[model samples]
Target: MTECDDTHGCDTISRRAALTGALAILASATARPALAQTYPTRVMQLIVPFAAGGGVDVVVRVVAEAAGDILKQRLVIENRGGAGTVLGSQAVAKAEPDGYTLLAAPTTMVINPALRSSLPFDWKTDLVPVAMIAKLPFVVTSGLKLPAKTMKELEALGKTRGTPITFGSGGANTVAHLAGEVFGLVSGAPVLHVAYRGEAPALTDSMSGNIDVMFSTLAGASAHVKAGTLRALGVTTAKRTSLLPDVPTVAEQGYAGYDLSAWVALVAPKNTPPAVVATLNAAVNGALAKPEIAARLIEIGAEPAPDTTAALASFMAKDAQTWAGVIKAAGIKGE
Candidate 1:
């Protein structure tokens, strides 16, 4: 072969490499839509960042079961509870940005970042909201041994008692814990926070009178309230919940603007295809729209709060901002 100029040979090689890269990128872009169109070729994993049988797990199981049916694909739930949801959340955050892996994130998704100084992953950048499943309000419950029957009475008792009133939470930086912090902030009571592995244990301690009070999700605390083991003082919502319509709201109980509820939403790893997000959102909303699912959610003390992806993103942003202020003001820290 004839000898070639050094610049021409190098330029030709560079042009070939550039064209190859562009073609590869174009192929990836074209493949994503097709992949999204036929998503869930196999079973998908939905991670619940809480222990099994807890409020979030229960509600997510229900919704996922129904949604899986709608999608005609099996949605396996994987409970990866630890580190106040940081463990499981980070798993989802770092997972492949495909539709196969999803997260059933609760209020702690935002609260954890708010209470902690640094996280292994960035909540704002590592995860993307897909759909909002439900809003489960907290019920301020006290053991029968506590000498308080209402929110005002509880506040008064905490103030007048010689010893600091003890409040139990699922864990530090959890929604229940933050709710207790908010109570302390507004009520000016000397409250002691006792952290446990999970809500079930803390609720058990509350019922056994080891703890005086708990700001628990309605699903976890309603049974005890109905059985008269724990007395419900008020719900942590702006309005009364259908599950406990007789009980008043914390906002109405002299703590205006104390509307904190544990909400569950579906999220995927960042950069998941938009088409996949839309598909999953539609599936979730369809499941929530089912009459039986809605009724069951209500019975379990959750309200089906299906929303579009954009709306869920806005809601999550606002929620994170609100809790950031609360955490900073109350000097809350992660464990």
Candidate 2:
């Protein structure tokens, strides 16, 4: 009688334990979707890795404002510009991966790792791509009297000039700098680089005949090109930018296969929930698809590029590899 009573008690306890385990699993499964649904119950922050009034900053604010409406939460912009975008980037990388903090990452994030051995964060591991917001084409602009209207003429001048041709950029290892180096490598022209505080100053110096040319931003140089102060020799991308439709591409100008452009994307700190990533991606792509949003981006020289997170990841990986090769060949170093 005693043995039978003990077995019955043990079975009853085991059944209760099993019931508890099942309920716990069921709760966990439902909790994640609930968390995603309730995300952004408050304001979120977007870190712009550049200063205010910059192209990236403007582009991010436009889309962020639209996305805020969709999510019913305000997305605030904070500019933490310093150390070649490293300061702002590290701020986001170390932020809590709770989907509230994000980085308005530019192409420089990918190239910086390859250019410098030590960085506060590892882009590959510390940050993850959320969405590809837009891409802007670059242009090769020269002073009106630089003695070269086309890239071929420029190459000949480089050969004949007593000193190597000087190409100025906003800073060392920036997209403009790399594009300038690429031009030299492909054309076999002896080129030297001049780094300035910013593209505006570099373009200023180029206008004064301090530099031979500049692989520059179309947005910043377009007005001068239109004003006849700066002559745009060629567009750097594979296709010509509509903003400067009259200019030919470097490839079309007989430098075939030479194509480059700068891009911007949204990135999040590591370990941010996948559901959060999905939500942000949807918001960003939706914002990009809106007609007004697209128009605004176009007005600023950015091509609206709404894409899946997976596509962004693949594109960035390939771009990083390409930049690594270019930086290595050009012997590019950090600022």
Candidate 3:
């Protein structure tokens, strides 16, 4: 009789625990969908960290248009350019993580935290990566009149020159700027780093011979390269870009193991509902995979690298480590 009483008590405890577990699961399942469905009840904003007409801006516009179509809402782009993207980044960092405020950020999103000492928000804790949109290839472009035709020849020129070659960057603490410094460190050359407000001004300076050389994105500088204004010496990736198929990669051009491919990605504030994040990620992945989107990206010298939130998180973490090493090696510190 005592054994029976004990057994009945055990059963009662097990049933109670089961009932509690089921209630918790039901609550979680119900809450997530409700939160996701209520998201973006108004117009959505896509924040671009750089000025308009830049490669990032172009990629953001493409995705924003497609996302608007998918979400049945007007997705607008807000340009908030300053402080090597800190101004814009902080804006997104502070926004409510409801899937309504999105950030169309670039590789600087990773670079900034490692290089800059003062930041308004912590990138790791504040931002949640949604997806990777495109991988941007960098080309070593020179004015048409410059004599260096290849990476080898360019390195030789820099070595022979009594002074450091002045290299223009899209901005201070940007991937382009860091690439120039990395090349300098690896090749044993003195590369004078020059910071520009944006890629357009830098490319313009490169085209008109105002700057000696620069690491310009294929998407932003290809038109000038094709127009005979700027000459492509070598691509800054491990493999040659399709837009400039004939141009050899920096590694192929005697700079072995050289690569610097920046990418554009979508991110939002943290704690956004998994379902809405999943939905946006799927839409972005699908749109990027479309032949039309892929072709347009290729035409503009951008490589589509679409992936889910998990993949993007891994990629972003790896990118952070890579840029951290580069920043330390180059001794690049922010103001």
In order, candidate lDDTs are 0.87, 0.86, 0.83
lDDT of 3 by residue, 1-335 (tens): 56347987879988999999999999987886786666557788888887777776777788778767776677899988778888888899999888888898789988887776678898789988888899998888999877788877777888997877788877778888888888888888888988876788788888888878988888888878888888998889998887888889888866788888899988888787788788778778878877888888888889889887998999899999988987887677666
TM-score, prediction 3: 0.87
User: Could you give me the TM-score of model 1 versus the true structure?
Assistant: 0.86
The TM-scores of all predictions, comma-separated, are 0.86, 0.83, 0.87
- Top lDDT model: 1
What is the per-residue lDDT of model 1 for residues 1-335, given as tens digits with 9 covering 90 to 100? 44345778878988999999999999988886776668877899999887776777788999999999988999999988888888889999999988899999888888777667789998789999999999988898988888899888888888897777799877778888889888988998888999876678888889889989987888888888998888999999899998889999988989989988889999999999888998899999999999999999888889899899999999999999988887887777664
Error at 229, model 3, angstroms? 2.1
Candidate 2 lDDT trough over 10 residues, lowest sum: 49-58
Question: Could you tell me which residue pairs clash in candidate 2?
Answer: none
Candidate 2: stretches off by over 4 Å: 1-30, 197-210, 227-229, 329-335
Ranking by TM-score: 3, 1, 2
TM-score of 2: 0.83
